[model samples]
Target: MPSLNKILLFLSSALATAISVLVLGFSMSIQWVETTMDCTSSGSSFSNGSAVVTLSLFDGTMTRIHCPFFGGQDDFEVFPQLAGIGGTPLVLHGLVVCVLVLCLLFSACSILISLYNSVSNPYETYMGPIGVYVCSSLSASFSVVVLLIFAVNVNNV
Candidate 1:
């Protein structure tokens, strides 16, 4: 029978795998930033309704996030197209996604190592007790980075 330590490792690794999968799945639903800007007509009696735009994690299709700055444009009513998303904010979004993928890879490695350990004693110097800790730490560190990046992007960018 497998020792209690091995069983615990296997269970923890399984939980980590589940959490990793969830993190990746959540990334698919991108949140968009929204803004509305009112347009002014020089010859009209009143102001036209504001344009409502939801700009979120830009995939390079839109020039930039919709801001109130567009109200200054005299001919905004003529063209309905918004600017393509760009700049450092886009870079951070990509960074979050890449780090998450790395986290998932490390978590998978941890799961495999622990599962092997449950069957038989993994070599102490190579893939058992030490390996589990290393992989778990790496996965956890990457997770922290991903969270920090996402938080900063949402708050500052």
Candidate 2:
């Protein structure tokens, strides 16, 4: 029984670690960009001349260098602005899916282990000190990671 708990703990910890590393890798590639119209003018012939708009990466709320124009018409030939990661959205979505799957797997395993221990070893004597410690620690740690990841996803959205 104790060995079973240890197995559950090992699995949960390994899964959580894998998920955190993966999320951090994906987040590393993410960047936020912001574009602001510095200036604009209306040409005499109804053809308005707008100042060259620049898009720059946001560095802690501060705009960085100018981003190259993506090319688009914005009511007046305004360049298509950029304000997100260079990587495709599909790539980011895949990474997110991987992280969520890992989280769900760990959460389910933890819950199942806890339930099994409660029913099979209700006497409390059956669970050795090490086994109890490992089980509880793993469940708590993975729960915390889940919460953190959820918060990160919410903020990203």
Candidate 3:
């Protein structure tokens, strides 16, 4: 017997949570780093070996290096780099993760509040929608900033 507004609110919050989870997962993936270099010879017109380096965050930071032509496969530790001057990307990543966590937490609270508001007495005061709006905006802004920082830093690298 919930109102249409309440139903929409619940659905929207759920959708936001799902989308945030997806974005966070994608962001944390190492696929973010992909580079190609040309080293062809003048007469042979052949392409040199190319390597793809990926950085992923799990129990610990990991870097995967793969070069099919050279038959080179190796993994390198990257945590030390985070302490160096080029650690801007890692710092930005941490910020993104923190913001996403906040977004998910607030959205979940919004969902629960909406459910309660729908089922409870009409006289009750509801603040869940406000929290949802604020959190959503904050999440969006932080996400954009993270993307920009990552893109610029990666390009520079």
Per candidate, the number of residue pairs that clash is 9, 1, 0
Provide the global lDDT of candidate 3 against the true structure: 0.57
Q: How big is the positional error of residue 51 in model 3, measured in Å on the Cα after superposition?
A: 2.3
Output the worst ten-in-a-row residue range by lDDT, candidate 3.
Answer: 58-67
Judged by TM-score, which candidate is best?
Answer: 3
Task: Report the lDDT tens digits of candidate 1 across residue range 9-117.
Answer: 7767767766766765566445444445454566775655566544333331222223334432222210122213456656777797788778878878877777777
TM-score per candidate, in order?
Answer: 0.56, 0.30, 0.61
Name model 3 segments beyond 4 Å from true.
1-5, 37-48, 57-70, 82-118
Q: Which runs in model 1 stand beyond 4 Å of their true positions?
A: 1-5, 27-83, 121-126
Where model 2 places Cα greater than 4 Å from the true spot, the runs are 1-88, 122-157
Model 1, residue 45: displacement in angstroms? Answer: 16
For residues 89-114, write the lDDT of model 2, one tens digit per residue.
33433444455455445545544444
